[model samples]
Target: MLSPSRRRRRAVGLSLAMAAMSVVVLAGCAPGGSDPGAPQRRSVNTRLADEPITIKLYTETNYTLYEELAHEFQRQHPNVTFEITKERYDVLLQNAPRLMASDNPPDLVRLDVQTDQVKDNLLLDLDPYADAYGWDRFPPTQLAPLRVSESGQRGEGSLYGYGINHSVTGVYFNKELARQIGMNEPPATMGEFEELLQAARDAGLLPIMQANAAGEANMTYQAILNQLLDRQTVEDWIYNVPGATIDVPESVAAARRLQEWAEKGYLNSDANSVDYTSMVGRFAAGEGLFMFLGNWQAAALDSEMEGNVGFFLFPPEDAGRPAIAMSTPGSLVIPAKAENPDAAAYFLNWTLTNSTARQTVADVGGSVPGGDPGRPLPDVAPGSVTEQTQEAFQDVAEGDGAIGFLTNATPGMFQNTLAPQLQLLIGGRTSPEEFAAKLQADYEEDLAS
Candidate 1:
């Protein structure tokens, strides 16, 4: 549902960008892009060569899902081995350009912010592979973020990557506490949601356990913004569409709503100081009744909270409107310079088709596996939050309400602009109007560079 990692992986989307900004990558990922020399296309034929082959995978995500996938795949192809290097998700995004340009590059890399990679020719264009693998038939919305136009804009163009799993952003509440408060069903609208927040607060529980250190208050803010605007408007802005903007009245209104939440004691008093890990840990420890987070946290929560937790999408203002959530696939891409392009392509195809691979992600990764959308879903442990996450994802995917995280509107936008502005807004130092204007300004400045 979002970039915030769960279990063994986490990406502070804004932190990744603010840190990545200092590296000075190619023409600042200018919309006017470059065409890199293409990797040789893989044959769609069924068999792999018998000779020993090693696929190099670079990722910041700790191997909860990856190590298992690699081992399981290697089991099937005895000759195939893996060399994987784990980096912090932030470091991985920061050094992406240089790593991809080195004399030797990884066969596949986990890419969170790929605009720069795609624009600079660091990533392999996957349209050819998509054709070979029948990936062209997968849900278009699931593939939209990975599709880059000739101008480097996302949402439409040749496919460049695929998510092994897709994520969803929504509200996670303590099921035990929910029943105590006489709430049996998820709120049907925003008004109903706010009432629950008030009830949780009145019961002396933290209504929302979001942290501001990584600017996580923005998670709730984006949840509200998701419903206020249509999917295309937000996705267009995040995809760097030529004139797309988020400094609209709806954005301002969303900011004001969050500010009011902060002022009214819905947010924890120490939210400004708490970090994401602590917040999630505290929530699972039973300190908070509800939290805003991505489905990435589901598997971990399932283990820690056991059967105590439940998740739901942010409800729309009107029940008749579609439910929208901040979501994007956890994208994996083949480097343009990958040593074994065909093997990498074949492995990616297997992830989509292999039953064991799909189930491992659901059971271990706590994520909703992304494959042929028409295919049956893999089984999850009964009563695990994973089931709800998968259902929420279906609602968003079918509703076409999957929008990129706002923190990803531009690298550094969160750290340099949104973070400080949100902190100030919560502290009574900035108006919501000022907050929206400042965000758009920073976005424009980043794109201009």
Candidate 2:
């Protein structure tokens, strides 16, 4: 899910309360409703003082971080154990709906901002749990994206999930390669960044390292789009705020910039054939000058290159404006059919609020601490890429400029519309105007349906 500000605007507390009541009444009134005498409520011990029990957790992204937190939790409560199954995100996205509805669903699952699963009634309504656990202490903006309306629209109504971290993406540069090309410092404006790209290309080095096969070519396009458009315009488009549209002059120019880079040989000629891992590996091996990707890649780069790697948000279109990067909460949700919802919620809460978990996030997760924006972040390894990423993330996040990912605006956009359209743009098969039109058309189609 893109970060909270771009998520739909939240409904007022009373309105949300009334909506929850209505949804409950409707659920109970359906023909052949759940067994009237069946236990509809289960006891949840927040202290985890119950009999020995193991909670099954299914997750995506940074499983090591989750394992570390789980071990810490176990030290506190010896009787509680976790059975974790980590899967690739593509596989999870493909099967989450069925898995979430199974007779024995995993207690916790990572989920995107998409609301189709919520519409299917596969995820739990977290409002009751939030009340019981006093989760209102979390910043409301952070909680907004996890909410889904009764009518199935996401961003407001009933809270369904919680995130442990916020992620931001930007330019990752090989400092040595940059210095070799005589560009010693990160650019201060988009125009200067373009000049750096040309300089790298002139030196016979890969100016941009991207994996088209992994859909990063589209992300490169978005990074440029972020530089061109203001935050509110992009947010309104991504969140489906009424009257939002993507076929604007700035977007057209952003698309054109991608085509220009492709023509100028700034982007890797074989980008379409490269996988994400290989692309990162090539960059680490000194094959590329810059790679546009998320902070999640920081640990690997830092481990390999040490001080050779540096991160910076793309420069703003206006040199005077502060930079804003696309960001989202790294989120997890409980399935409606989960057998141990309480344990899962406990784990989620512990991971976000516990000091040990926060340290792990700061050190290895390549994301900012999730709970309570006012809380101080644990110090990361000194002079590390993780440290640089954490600083950049905090700057953008607190500056009120972090925006949503365009791919999350509508389901299937990354796979269906953006991936192919971007490939076409890079291949010189589609004009920028045409590319913008296709995107807007798809956006309107999804809205109409």
Candidate 3:
């Protein structure tokens, strides 16, 4: 399934450091473990009477939400302005480190590689601000992805970044297509879900819509593992905890399930040829009964298919188990050498605590509120896909069932390992055990490096 020589080459490519992270490290990310400095705490409460200041923000995501948030922030503090530079995700990844290392670094940036960037001292540790601003008011799980240890170990410790919104992954069903297949409710167990897929196939409808070419196969593969394994086991693997392994029975079983589905013709024969946008478009146009995807596609699907589409967690192995899904927070970071650290921290604090900002996050940002549960829910259109998305996020977040993305298990695992192995599996060139073994090997190699 995985060629050792090729795997070694990919590993070496990563070891050479993704070009952006290869940028010169300065001071070893807060040498000797000293604090970055106190955040601009007074700015949060003090009313700046037209005091002129501009904050530069570099981002590669959530353009609309950030644009809205910036406008609202400027509205409240008339003199505070934003110089936001939006770039493609890859371009930003390659350039952010050098830019952050420059004398006039952007005040804020949406960091995609925290573990790598933090090791270079490119990101400011936001622990002080978290303490001063009561950031713990939000669910602790919501903050886990944003925090990292002094050694750049992720999953638990000092806060490096804060998320504006959170995302969930699961099944997006076309109700109309499901009706044609005689399914009226979301399946509650693995067997029941497979029955639904079979029913759709029997009715001459494509059962699941996925683009293997764009690496969409990993979502389903991961959902299966989430169903079979407990939260802690999966978390251990993803967080790089010592002694963690992905070759366990649960993971092997999960891989087999995906292979079974592929053989049953539940997936499209041409799945390898389609791109992500086209795959979603085909699903929206009613080419398939169910689509395995993340909530990031909710807004667009709502716009395209409206009430025709509904979402649910991928069913657990046992119907009795609590539903678990792949989930994570949006990425935000402050540059270590930012010109206005206090103002940047102030904006971050406002977004997390302010009711108006939370509402915008839920409604305009098309994500659940990134604040505490006690806070009021955003007013979404009744029974809309947006409402369903928020409910899904709430269930997983409050139920302790949410887990970070599988791709996050290693820096480049998604592209270098996962995508190719899954392609081979779906194409009948690799067995399930072989597929799982390859993944475990790559994970171990990355961990060792």
Candidate 4:
């Protein structure tokens, strides 16, 4: 019906039309075409960008991930900077009081639970700020330890510190070593645990690697004592309730039990001299069946053993009672002498709820309180160990029995008095009765002071 040139023109027009239609279809498949009214996505700035504030932070130990965290924080907050200072645990503890006494104390401080000394008058109450920032993301159980009584307030208290991570003290066992000695599972009772220790010794393996050189070595003995004595008895002994004495039956029994374990070769020969870092390495090398430590060492175990490590609740001694472990969340406090309390509060808020920051903490070998267990943790030992630790803590918190530790609950001076005395007991320098008497005398003196 048309000439050759006309036909060619028509073909070209049809091809172009089809091509245009294809483009239209592809355009529909592309993003943002169908929804013209859709809101533009905003980028989340996790750091204090453009904020003209600087906060000084003091902490113990060096962690690479924390440096990364600081960098990421700086990236998000271009105007905000951190002045960070790190020291060894003992040095940090020793310097904390001196720093707080000065006019230029650090804005943010990472304090040990036992050093509740500075917590009383040196830290600021964070109730209003925490409430304003919606820190209700974590439950009260996680926040209880950091709460302090406000000045001139009888019953009212406010959180002065916030902890990004928690540590649980418990027994870490080597599964391979356990299997070699026909122990496929962890001990559920103290008696069974003792038997396991004996078995490990018989197999020519060290049963327990205790780091007694560190002044904190007494922490282990305290943990053992907690299992033997009720919370009220411990509190009474610590507070020096009239006529209360560690020389009583309970303290004597706990000391004797520890002495028996040491005599039975349950502890390493040079345990009194081993430091914390060395103790961890020894356990990792399979030199021992079990080691008592905090979950702060989780990252190390994850990196070294991958999944060969397992955790157990402190085994129960009395029948019909559930076993539990000790848990203490590290705290971040603002010194009363802080030059920048407002900025410190802002940083605290940012750290607590920031998803990436929390994940970084978990990755670096610490567990977030009230965090989802299903989250991926790269260097974690095993989820099962964490679960068991959590379960034990929950039992202690929920059970009709009292829930707390003397080291954390008692005043700093009293803790100091007890630590060295307990160490002497462990080193076999003090008899059980004498150890109890010394504790009683210290408690009475502390209460009077």
Please name the candidate that would achieve the greatest lDDT relative to the true structure.
1
lDDT of each: 0.78, 0.76, 0.76, 0.61
Assess the local accuracy of residue 189 in candidate 1 as a C-alpha lDDT between 0 and 100: 97
Instruction: TM-score winner between 3 and 4, please give it.
Output: 3
- Indicate the residue-level lDDT of 308 in model 3: 92
Off by over 4 Å in 3: 1-54, 61-64, 74-106
Q: Model 4 Cα displacement at 196 (Å)?
A: 0.3
TM-score of each: 0.84, 0.87, 0.82, 0.77
Clashing pairs in 1: 1-167, 1-168, 5-10
lDDT of 4 at 340: 74
Residues 264-333 of candidate 3: C-alpha lDDT, one tens digit per residue: 9998878877767678889988888988987767776788898898988888878778879887887678
Could you tell me how far off, in angstroms, the CA of residue 236 lies in candidate 3 after the best superposition? 0.3
Model 2 clash pairs are 3-328
The collision pairs in model 3 are none
Model 2 clash tally?
1
* Candidate 2 C-alpha error for residue 105, in Å: 2.3
Sorting all predicted structures by TM-score, with the top scorer first, yields: 2, 1, 3, 4
List, residue by residue over 1-449, the lDDT tens digit for candidate 2.
Answer: 12434333233232111111111212211112465323344344455446897888777643356666777788877989888888756557667777877777888877765666666667777776676566787888788777777665657787888878888889899989999889877798999999999888888888998888746686788888887877788887777777788898999999999899889999889988887778888999998898998887787788899889988888887687876888788788888788777678777877766667777776667777777554556766666778777778767866877777888777767777888888888889999999999998998787667
> How many residue pairs clash (N, CA or C atoms closer than 3 angstroms) in each of the candidate models, in the order given?
3, 1, 0, 2
